[model samples]
Target: MAKERALRRAAREAEAAKQRARRARIVARRQRRRALLTRLMPRRRRTGRLLVRRSRGQRAGIAVVTLVLLALVWFLVDDIALRLVLTLLGLLCLPALVVVALGRRTS
Candidate 1:
């Protein structure tokens, strides 16, 4: 019984070691692939000014689209209840917008 228990414990240890080695090999292979990819692909350097300008343009486009959509909705909708719901939705979005603006400022 003692020998049987010892043999079983050894087998379990061996299996665990094998699993650890397999995991190590997988991690090493992934690291090698990542390095190879980085070597093969060139990274582009973007200027801060360009990024800021592009973001501003995007913000302006979004504002214009939102205004146009809101105008259309206002003209098409006759129910005051729907308009009130829309207004409530807009108000709910305001806090989220404020949080995003604050988060961006910190970054």
Candidate 2:
């Protein structure tokens, strides 16, 4: 019975080692693929200026609110030119508006 138990334990350990090796190979393959893709892709130059620092939640909330407001303007407004003008002005003033709304950081 003891000899049988020993063999079973050895088998389990061997299987675990095999699984670990398999996972390592998978990780290495993923890393290689990522590296190759990154090399192939052209690097994007960040030409835009930093507007404001906001948390992810804040950014998401702003996006949702902006979408809702745009939708309202699209449905409610009669003139297409007026809607386009409003959208352009809103986008241009967004950074300043956010900074004003958020106020200065204490820390």
Candidate 3:
């Protein structure tokens, strides 16, 4: 009876050790996958950090669109003073539009 009990306990201990090793491997694999995903993914900037990157072509495109939109608004309005005000407002918004088009990034 004593020999039998010792044999059973040793088997149980070996099984438990195998289970522990399996769990450790699973955890390591998950951590590696997480690290790989993070490396591949693009990092996002915080809300307070609002720097945008604009290529030369993109900047020109934004400028052209802003001008065209401003011109259309000016042509639609009948009153000269109102047209001037709208144009000025559009001009003020030009930078903002470009910034939006450029897209925000941390790096």
Please give each candidate's TM-score.
0.46, 0.47, 0.45
lDDT scores for all predictions?
A: 0.73, 0.85, 0.82
Please write out the lDDT profile of model 3 over residues 1-107, one tens digit for every residue: 99999999999999999999999999999999999999999997555633336556766787788879888987899999998898999888877765676656545
Q: Alpha-carbon error at 29 in model 3, in Å?
A: 0.2
Candidate 1 per-residue lDDT over residues 12-107, each given as its tens digit: 999999999999999999999999999999986666564353367656765675677567667888998997777677656854764465345422
- Candidate achieving the largest lDDT: 2
lDDT of 2 by residue, 1-99 (tens): 999999999999999999999999999999999999999999976646453456667888889888888888889999999999988888888878877
Model 2 gets an lDDT of 0.85
Model 3: residues with Cα > 4 Å off, grouped in runs: 49-107
Q: How well does candidate 3 score on lDDT at residue 17? A: 100
Error of 1 at 76 (Å): 21
